[model samples]
Target: MTVSVATSSRDMIEGALARAVQFPRLRYMGSKYKLLPHLARAFADVDGATALDAFAGSGVVSYLLKAQGYQVTSNDFLNFPSAITRATVVNQTVKLTAAEVDTICGEPADDRDFIRRTFDGLYFTAADREFLDSAWSHIDLLKGHKQAIAISALVLAAARKQPRGVFTFTDLRYDDGRRDLHLPLRDHFRERVEDYNRVVFNSGQTCQTRSGDVFDLPAKSYDLVYLDPPYAPPRDDNDYIKRYHFLEGLSVYWRGQKLMENTKTKKLEKKYTPFSYKRTIVDALSRTFEQFKDSTIVLSYSSNAIPDAGTIKDLLGAVKSDIEVREIDHKYSFGTHSTAQRRDVSEYIFIAR
Candidate 1:
């Protein structure tokens, strides 16, 4: 049977992104943080359901589902996403006090000054370097949920305030030429901190964000698994996630404060053999779906095509006897942009029984 979950809450917001803490400065395409309401409406009948949000990008969909009271198992391959997903969907509770917020905002400016005072030869600005160092040093005083919320807010603020707009991933830093961009330090930090405070005080959802490959998840453990993996293929000669290396670092840190570079991966995959031409993704995913042979499966895709809508249905149809399809008009055209990608976003919602 197919169920849509659109139940309501008053002015309720998702945890991490609502605080703008997760992405910090990432402006990547197809981030679903803003698509929650639409997705909520789309999956409205999914009340009291169990879900396994596989890709868990921003955990927006997962958070919304949990907000609507779905039993959610949110997972991601990246650390920042895993941290964000957990901070928002799982550990989200209304536990911060006004005193904590006051303390966070009121940390001695002297600490920041000390950290930044040493910012002679560095990537970020003097103020930014100072704030980051100060923030990290003071983290122990932040308690449990407050620490997560503050860090989220701090990262978000740092990202927006960064002149180069780079937060996690650093390809190669230039000593000069960074001055071409200027983000006002004070206003940006305050905005991010405020957002951090708000999200900590607002969210209440039961969720978990784990860092691991999608294919590794236990089969049939989730009532639903929303997949939005990278469409770009990865191989010795294919293109893939290049600007997202910082995400790897973040996940490593979150799993228990370890910072180690992945020297194992020597180069980027520069080209993609078509999905049909290569059965790797489908093979692994299909194996996963077999475990969910009795659960609902929702797949979201776009056509820089991995498995287009029709093809996906055929794959999913192998498991469920009853399947329903709904397509949302994801309008991408915005006016007055010299370099805005206006690709059509036709999200196919497949509900299988």
Candidate 2:
């Protein structure tokens, strides 16, 4: 029989506020922001005051756990999400005040900026590029979560200006009159900062952010470990690095970054991650389970992804005594293009103890 964990008073408060508190509006494709309610229900029985969010993409899961009174340690290989996690989860009380926002915005824009030199007409407007350089300069000077909050706002602004809410190559064939392409950069940025600043609250615990491979985390026993790695699509590329590499560059301030040659997309040159590939997924899952076997594991995966649920259960079975899978009906964050494929899908949560 499947036994679920009980929710605390903090959990009840957070669950109610989860609907009220708006998360940073990110355009990431596979974000679990919409599924937080279902996820909270699935893991309600897990024994944990502390959690390690192994693949904290978009940081919604980590932030939610933090709100529910968990001491969350959020890790993602990319710098962008790590910044968000640091700002929202790890941050106990630091928030960007209204006066600070004005100071950050009033910083001088450099024409010969790194973004202008590197990304001319690639992802953003020349003006937008210049503003970003100025924003980065001021943001880099600040320490800790203050910097994180500003950076998060900038990231959100950049993503909003891009088509399809991602950094993929845009077709300029019929680009005669696109209003969104010409939206005012600074105004949008200010609005984004205001939006992010409004949501800053004390999660009641000091969290942490780590950016690197999942295996490299400090060997310590967490009460629970949540994994939400990239899904291996059947016929399309779901590689997040390729999708959000621009944001990564922006997070790192594009210092001495390597760019892909002969490609219009201008994605950053990145090393291959096994979780982004189909053939290596089983090995990745097995290794992760083995590495964190000391803690209760909660894995979020799609019903129609690589390795299949049975394979995953078998892999988890080797590491833990009990395994339970919960299936929640869900839909894609972005609409499906194929007429043959339905928009509806099932999201599976594998719980192991």
Candidate 3:
């Protein structure tokens, strides 16, 4: 069944974005959110197409596909990436009452439990920690698809109350004295069902969820393979996946683990692919493209990290009969301005047939 696309719902847009004031999700130095509209325009040829976001960070692109009423299949090895997908792209309509929000977020709970201890000395005010301490526990008792949906909502709420200041890209809330919750995630979920009711009520679905490398995608299974792998380099002598505490945190949130304090070391299982090395990067992408075979291949790459636009074009042309290159013009949302104040970025879209 087709879920009605309600892009014009202003209330949901307001409620859903309560957390947007902070670290909402799937964001990095080089994210695809700014390019989302352009990406959608480029894919104008695609309708009712089953879409896949292989590297579903923040699930923004996947959510975009979902918002467009496409059958979106999002897969990301990272924990937070998948969580955002479950919350925004593949969530169920939640029937919530204002009383439920109060019980879930406004009340007090034990702050010295394992979950609270996990975030000790971090940025979450005592009230924030207690809220999550109770809320996550409540969400955890449920099972199956409902679990994903509940946790998605709960995490958005809990992450806001965290000491780390709602949506910061930085590590901890009080680690370096930055304790302001940039975006109040709790405020977003406080309204819960009413926030994005019109949009999220229809619910979204995905094909699979696996904890594995991007190169492990099955052969000849998907119609389009969307790749949004990491653009950051690994820390000195550490694996790239190991540095993925952000992802693990989201996974833990899925399990209803409330992290009240930032810690010396992030706790979770980290997965990494051989993406930093040039040969490995090419080989892995080549294999992924090969597995899809003839499927319209659309890639999201940054001008700063991935191969030059020309190299990508040549590679795609060699792999498919047709190649379409769209230089997603730099806009206010995607950075790369003529001004000298903020960081600049340029992204490219390569379409292969």
Candidate 4:
């Protein structure tokens, strides 16, 4: 199943490594931004030229693989994250121009008051809601990678402006007086556009992005597959759509989505994912490992999760004989205090082949 690549020169590999660091930082939950160095080192020994990031939450791991010159495929069920990978990973040279940015941030041509009517005083200010409705109208006019870039910027802007970068709550209870909260949504959009643009670089490899259930992907073989599924913690929940429903709706302009009118936050109904529930997680992991058994697999799990590190190793061992585990002490920035008073936990990496 290993895809052979032409031998890369030392200079070429170094150049790729250098470009990997240019990826922009995100305030996303469960992001692997701080562990990039650890991930890079773990992947240093991989001899493959093709890799699949099965659950590219923040797309940082996919960007890392692409920078290492692996023809990377980044997949996420969430449209906002998929848009991010589309803008950065799949999009090599396409960038949104100043005129395009201005157009997207300008007034709407028609009286589209969807956000204003649907979300008045719920998430953002009145002016911000008007701007969002206007920007989404202009964003729809863009095509291909340009549209993806705009969506990515818009989503990032909304996340940054929201207190704690999530939509699970409407109040500023957890407000830490951060600078991102004070910034206007439109200003954040403009700044994020520049950040995404600066991260765009030619990796000289054809990368791709997919938005769907992981099992729905075509049965394509890659030399390496990285798995970082949502950790179903022993306590609390990992419902991403609940925390990001606004961004998800905005990603597709709520075309086919129906808001749950009974919900306090006006959030959409939660999408079903086996990885998020303790009852289905073990089976889900087993199936995932068995599906990609032909490829070298690297899994990231947490100490506090439902299926412990030993259970994960056992699951991987069932597919591959050779196995190795690496442990790193990592502290999460966001989590429910009800789970544990301390945020510190051990991050586990399991390599199976």
Full-model lDDT for every candidate: 0.52, 0.77, 0.53, 0.85
What TM-score fits each model?
A: 0.69, 0.90, 0.71, 0.94
User: Residue by residue across 1-353, what tens digits does model 3's lDDT show?
Assistant: 64333332444444434333232442243456666656665444443356677777656677666554456777866565565566555665544445655655554443335445665544455545455566666555555544555555655444433443223333453344333244344554554324333335453444444444666666445555566655532222223333445335644652543333333443444344666555466666666666665567788776655455676676666678877777655532222122313435567787777
Ranking of candidates on TM-score, top first:
4, 2, 3, 1
Give the per-residue lDDT digits (tens) of candidate 2, residues 218-324. Answer: 99998889999888776676767677778888888866667785678878887578877888988998999999999999999887678788888999999998998
Model 3 misplacement above 4 A: 1-29, 95-99, 106-112, 144-146, 157-198, 203-211, 232-247, 253-269, 277-279, 331-342
Clashing pairs in 2: 4-45, 5-44, 5-45
Stretches of candidate 2 off by over 4 Å are 1-21, 107-112, 171-182, 333-342
Model 4: per-residue Cα lDDT at residue 284:
96
Quote the lDDT for 285 in model 4: 96
The 10-residue segment with the lowest total lDDT in model 4: 333-342
At residue 288, what lDDT does model 1 achieve? 56
lDDT of 4: 0.85
Clashing pairs in 4: none
Q: What C-alpha lDDT, on a 0 to 100 scale, does residue 146 get in candidate 1?
A: 58
Kindly indicate the candidate among 2 and 3 with the higher lDDT. 2
Highest lDDT: which candidate?
Answer: 4
For model 1, residues 140-192, the per-residue Cα lDDT tens digits are 46655556655555545544443333333333342244432355443454565
In candidate 2, where is summed lDDT lowest over 10 consecutive residues?
333-342
What would the per-residue lDDT of candidate 4 be over residues 180-227, giving only the tens digit for each residue? 887888899999999899988887889999888999989999888999
